[model samples]
Target: MSGYLFAILAAAACVAAFAGVYRARAIGAVATTGPLKAHSRPIYHGLNAAIWTAVPAFVVLLLWLAFQNSIIDQFVIGAVPGSETMESSARSLMTSEIRQVAAGNIFRQPTPEVQAAADHLRSLQAVSTYLLVAVTLAIAAIGAFLGMKVVSARYRARHSVETAVTIFMMFSSLVAIIITLGIIGSLVFEAMHFFAKVPVTEFIFGLRWEPQIAIRADQVAGQGAFGVLPVLYGTFLISGIAMLVAVPTGILSAIYLAEYAHPRFRAVVKPLLEILAGVPTVVYGFFAVLTVAPAIRAIGTAIGIPSSPNSALATGLVMGVMIIPFISSLSDDAFSAVPRAMRDGSLALGATKGETIRKVLLPAALPGIIGGVLLALSRAVGETMIVVMAAGLIAKITANPFDAVTTVTVQIVTLLIGDSEFDNPKTLAAFALGLVLFIVTLILNLIALRTVRKYREKY
Candidate 1:
């Protein structure tokens, strides 16, 4: 039934879009006679009409789809005797579970009330689909008819269409900005709640590292400790090690691509770098655990240094490999953004290519390069899978990269991965951690933007 409704909606949308296009083109052809005719071509006019016809109807269809399931479930729950005794949301869940069972997705038999509710829901769905299809088709047909009628000699279709398209583009850009602000707003609210429970000073400045809390009100071993020192230490350790591996390797690769490597080498290298980015982090995590950790351990033992099976070194090194493409790609763009004249001027003044690059190009691209590094660092800080799988989950405050350590992201994942009560502070703590991570990344991005702007002004 859902599939049938979707098919009808799709057909209606296509019809509306094609109708709008036809109307706009006919208007363009007729309206060319009068003085001050619109500048845009007939096809543009047609495209504008087609977009308008599709947009509103498709929006309506989406809204209908979103509400349909809830409305049907509510109706079914309301019909069932004693359903009102259950909480409204719980009743909805029960109804949905029964529906699943009735549809043969589950083996368990539902009670009489649940079975009745499921039957009612199926009936409601059938009725809703019929109504939705009727409404959508009616709207599409009306819109198409109106559009065809509006195509006349006096109508200025082209100008109107272009203006609408420009407005649409601006609106599209605003949606992205609005969504970013929304996420930040949500983060702020949760962080504020966390700060209320755990003092900001302790979270920010405490020296200890523990996140254990009593699950039951009576059982008490470790509770009320919210120190973040270990998590911060782990973050810095892993990030620092990653940078140590990534920076030199990435910079050399960028230099080769920009200054030394032939076009042939570059053609192969760029795609391979992109392929590195495409590889899933989970796959990299496996590689780190199976390959890198054992190798690091062997080397450590041979050199008379004790190394844990789950050391920061392994995770950090693998993370660095993951970040290499990010650094190299961004660095390549930064280098490319440096004007050719600057390098040519230095070389013409008797400087070697290396000297010119070192003195002129590097300085010019420094700000952008820093921005890229900060971006990569932000990613490292938030990275969960690599650290979770390779770096041990034990939160320990340590400076040694060869020791087991954990990060904020790892804790957040551990805290929220399984079933937990909604009201539990442990679960809520994940939101607080998320909020902190969001703010840190946001600040880093703003700093990078400012740095780049300053650099541009200088150059």
Candidate 2:
């Protein structure tokens, strides 16, 4: 029914737009032959009418939808016998049952009063929807009339439309900012709970990464180690290995596609390369577990290297493959953003193509390339599934890529898995890890932004 209201509102807006256009055209018809016609175009007047007709109706519909269910639940509970004495939680559960029954999802026999309450709930909803439709349509019609009435030869509809657009853009940006703050606030709040029990220094600088807390006094683990260093070390090691594999290949491919490939070939190959990015991380995880892990283990065994079944090398390599498009696509855009004049002038100076690319184009695009690498590095750092499947679950300080090591993301998931008491450090530890990861990503983004500013300066 809400969707139907949207469709109706849209249709009314279209009709209103046409009416406004007709009214404006009629008003300006006499002045067309004169020096000054309408101050704003008929299209702007039409848009103004559409906005007036849709916005109030949309707002009313949203408010109605948001509040109607709660109102219904309150009224129905009050009307139902024996509901008044129930606890708040009981009332909530009863509300759920009533809604399920009203929605035709009844699993068992209901009392006569419940059946009647369901009927009452349905009837109220129907009446509310009908009233909503009537009220909104009336408002829209009045708005359309007012909008068209204002459409005179001297009216400034274009200014009004531009102001509305600017306001909308500001609102969108405000919403994004609020949501970002909310996420960071939540991470910090939960992380505070973690730090209350465990000292900050122990969590941050300690070398061990065992997060399991003993449930009983006699448990050999006692208070399990909460050191985050091993986890941080593994994360950086995997990310470092991934960056090593990704950087050269991605940048080279970008250079090839941007500078050397035929247009048609570039179009085809670039999309194919980007297709790798579209592949799910879980799918990559499966590929790592089934294919890459075994291959690495075989190579290690043949070369007299001791390799774990689940090795960081396999996870890092696959993760590198996954993020190739991030670097490649961004690098391509960066190279394309570089002035063709620079390339042409370098060639004019008798520099070879290779020399021109190395000395001229590469330097020009370096900032953007760095920005892309940093973004990709952040992406590689945050990835969970690939590392979860390919890399071993043990968090320990290790330099060998073939040795099993777990990352911060993996630890977060492991710590939070199954039933966990929120007050316990084991569960709270996830939030601490999350806060660290969030800070890392934030720093990366800031660096990326700084590089972008530098790139803009060059252009």
Candidate 3:
């Protein structure tokens, strides 16, 4: 049987078993009133039984699925004539071919050895399916029987169920934490390898970034520079421009919507504003390239100013437009969260509407506002599609918005594209760029968290 079919059968069996056990226990508790008065509800007894039946069977199923392929491959390899003499890579390739033949996905006719191995694989898979079904059902039945045996008045089924659920939740949380740690660990480890080849100082402080190393000895441009400052500068330059556009406009729009707009107008305007957030970044990239870039170039030419066809200004402007809804929606919530009483008090004390908003509501909502802006800044910094499509790939350390520039994310994408050898510095440098970006983003988040906490405590 397929895993999903088995899972469905197991779940149904557990449910039916739990229902029967719960009904019997409840009837028993009711019949013997004094000493056997139920300590927990019938639902708790049922849940406890269900958990016992499902958890163990699921764990066994998972372990089997995890190791089944490798175990079967080993058996297939041993059965194939002369397979033991093959190198590991050759064995792996043969194993893959056997699987392809078994699945009938082979592009060419298989040799007799491979055909024999494929037949054996199919037989093993058939046997394994029967065994999986038998073992899973047997374990579920045994677990259900044991769980039902313990169902009594003083069993504390509720406590047992709650503890199990709590443990499961903690495990789920730890899984997330471990996954995040794994990502960081991988990035750091690869980045360390990169740093060993290219000095940390040169990568961080050097001005040029030419990571194209020649694969052939006779190829020109063999020496590749690993400087990161140019990309970093471009990232900050674009992000800064985006924030400058987003912050004031979003905050003011939020303030107007929260404090002044009519209810109907607010309802309509809010969704329209938030719709910008839902639009894909790729769409924004197209807008930047087809519309914004040309307009800026035309205007710059008319005004006697030089503008690159692929300029930071065009990308940053479009990116800022994309981030507006993030800042506005979040800041709107923050502003709306400020108590009406505070606003009334400010007004009663002879403050103008604008003054009351500026001094009372905005100040009260500053923490959330700052948090929202920081989040928007992160969004702007991490944007890839817009930068890739609109901002040119030339990494230059210029403050002028009209100059072509690139970001760390864009460079990372460029470096890792196609079939890349991980050992090469060109590819490893992507991880190095990723590590720095991760660190920078982490630091920003830490600062935002600290600021939010301090102000939350004060408020």
Question: Global lDDT of each model?
Answer: 0.77, 0.90, 0.88
Question: In model 1, which range of ten residues has the least summed lDDT?
Answer: 36-45
TM-score, per-candidate, Cα-based: 0.84, 0.88, 0.90
Window of ten residues with lowest summed lDDT in model 2: 450-459
Give the residue spans of candidate 2 off by over 4 A. Answer: 33-36, 71-91, 101-127, 213-223, 415-423, 449-457
Best of the two (1, 3) by TM-score? 3
Q: Tell me the tens digit of each residue's lDDT in model 1 across 262-376.
A: 9999999888986887889999999999999999888888888888898899999999999888888888888989888888888889999889888888878887688678868
For residues 314-394, write the lDDT of model 2, one tens digit per residue: 999999999889999999999999988999999999999999989888878987788779878988998999998999799
Model 3 is weakest, by summed lDDT over 10 consecutive residues, at 450-459
Q: Model 3 segments beyond 4 Å from truth?
A: 6-10, 17-25, 28-36, 78-87, 107-112, 345-352, 454-457
lDDT of 3 by residue, 370-401 (tens): 87898899899889999999998999898678
Which candidate number has the best lDDT? 2
Could you give me the TM-score of model 3 versus the true structure?
0.90
Off by over 4 Å in 1: 1-39, 71-120, 185-201, 213-218, 222-224, 302-304, 457-459
Residue 44, model 1, lDDT = 50
Candidate 1 achieves a global lDDT of: 0.77
lDDT, residue 396, model 1: 75
